[model samples]
Target chain A: MEKATEELIKETAKDIFFKQGNLHATTQDIADAAGVNRSLLNYYFRSRDLLFEQVYNEAVQSKRSQLDEALDADLPFREKVERFIDVYLRDMRKYPFKEAFLISEINHKDFVLKNKKKSAKLISFLDEIAAEMKKGTIRTMDPMHFLVNLFSMLSYPIIMSPLYQQLFNLSHTRYENFIDERKDIILQSIFI
Target chain B: MEKATEELIKETAKDIFFKQGNLHATTQDIADAAGVNRSLLNYYFRSRDLLFEQVYNEAVQSKRSQLDEALDADLPFREKVERFIDVYLRDMRKYPFKEAFLISEINHKDFVLKNKKKSAKLISFLDEIAAEMKKGTIRTMDPMHFLVNLFSMLSYPIIMSPLYQQLFNLSHTRYENFIDERKDIILQSIFI
Candidate 1:
């Protein structure tokens, strides 16, 4: 019973904080959303701040692990890059505000930085690119720039879709298709 | 004196609304920030919402015109693209939250969509891309896809810089430098 309640609280809290953009959600708001009493929140997570921290940490972890595993996987360089973009776009689509919420909370005093473990994951991705560059499969450029370009291509469309939709007068279907259309262009941009 | 008070109120309202993220800023907040009584805000703009609308409209107008004039100019295609990216990066730096803020307010129940004038501006940009495509200077693809790539490369980094900085361990200077390095690669990606 206690385990179920705790999981319920966490799921509800993630929905509220991440999906709903209720960064200021109080214990009552979360408890109410979860359909549990206020005391249950305290019993489960102790405080609103702690609940938020746990949720945010899990979100960041899950995202990093997704990328780390994809990049660290044994696959052709372009294939891995394509899979990375696909997973990222799907995640962004699922949690439309995830990136925005992350940006807002990234600098908060209570936000913990937990990136010491990511470097080990990044090395192989860089090495793969270096090998390709040596073979002239891709242009000789700083791997960091290549990574940044790849990420920028994937994320900006998702984040700024609303504005661009209006600018281009695109219907809802066209907007989604626009994102679906980026994989080829992004790969061509990365490889020579 | 009247004109000065109106300008002061508008400036304060923008600082409060956009920079400070004070979407719910009251008349009192604007008056306090501008060192004027709440009455002058209504006296000049008749309501806080009107002042906000005017400021938001002017911002969009100025931005569209900047792009319109730049694209319509008779510069070489690559040079024009470089200049546009430069101005865009400068603007994003000046108002880091402008795009985010615009996205949020763009869906406000009372928000007006004024994009009819922009199509005229965008036509020349599309024509230029088509010209390049015909000349084989750039690959043949959907003009829309080409544009989405161009914008995604330019914007995603600025919008999601905080997350990437933390993940990549970039200092402020390094982050800025990363954006500066993208221009050459982005142009290369667009043109053969």
Candidate 2:
């Protein structure tokens, strides 16, 4: 019962924090939204600040784990990348404000988004990239550059979707479609 | 003298808004930073909100003008693109927080960033992109997709520099070097 209540509070907090843009949302707000008491929220998170930090960390960690899965999957290199893009696009649609929140956090705050475990995963992903380069499935270049290029293509449009819409006079529907069309566009650009 | 003071206030407000993330910085703050009195700021801009909107619009307009110059340059398509990348990289380094500030404004606020003149500029850019495709100087594809891909590559790395640093374990110096080297990587990927 306690674990379930704690999970509920955290999930509700994530929704309210990321979706609602309530960075300063109070514990009372979380409790009210979670249908629990304030004390229960405090018992789970100690403080609002701690809750926010945990939520941010969990978000990054979850994304890292998903990348780990996609990169570690026993698929061909291009297929693996395509799967990763699929996951990335789906997540971007799910959490439309995520990149904005991340940009603000990274730019304006002293919050250290540290993850010792995820560093290893990043190295592994890079290693997979290097292996793909060796196989000539991807162009022979610095593996790091390839990784950066792939990520830039997958994320740039989605992160700047609104600006793209504004710049191109694209409605929301067209903007979303533009991003949806990027999978093949990105893949075609990357693969030989 | 009055125009200079107005420019000073505008520049100071931009510094506080983008660099310091003080979206709600007061007229007094701008005046103090500009070394002018609050009445002078109000006299020039009429109100704080008006000042902010002008600052935002002017930033967008300046960038659009820069792009117009680059796209209109009488160079070959590839060289023209390289020149634009150089301009973009220089501007991004000059104003690291611009994208973050833009993202926050676009995502969280009701502000509409409108510029009727710039819509014509975008059309010209697309026309240029289409011409390049027809000449086989660039890949044969939808001009809109090419523009999106080009802008995505140019802006994404700069916009997400801090996050890229965290995720890739890049120190500030190394991360900068990575971005510096991307002009070729991006251009080569785009052009035949």
- Scored by DockQ, the top model is 2
Pairs in steric clash, model 1:
none
Q: What is the C-alpha lDDT profile of model 1 across A1-192, one tens digit per residue?
A: 579889999998777755654555668888899999999988878887788778877888788888887787677877888889888878877776666556656633345566563477787677777888899977777887778778877777776777778778887798888878788877876776
In candidate 2, residue A57 scores what lDDT? 74
- What TM-score does the A-chain of candidate 1 achieve? 0.84
- What tens digits encode model 2's per-residue C-alpha lDDT throughout A101-189? 66665544355556343367568778888887788766766677887787777777776676777777777797778887888888877
Clashing pairs in 2: none
Tell me, by TM-score, which candidate is best.
Answer: 2
Interface RMSD of each: 3.8, 3.5
Lowest summed lDDT across 10 adjacent residues in model 1 chain B is found at B109-118
- Kindly report the docking quality category of candidate 1: acceptable
lDDT of 1 by residue, B123-169 (tens): 66888788888998888887777877887777777766777777778
DockQ, candidate 2, comes to 0.38
Question: lDDT tens string, model 2, B1-192?
Answer: 467777888999888766655444568878888888899877898786788779877777777777787777888667878998898878777676666566556544355656343367668778888898888766766788887777777777777776778777778799889988888888878886
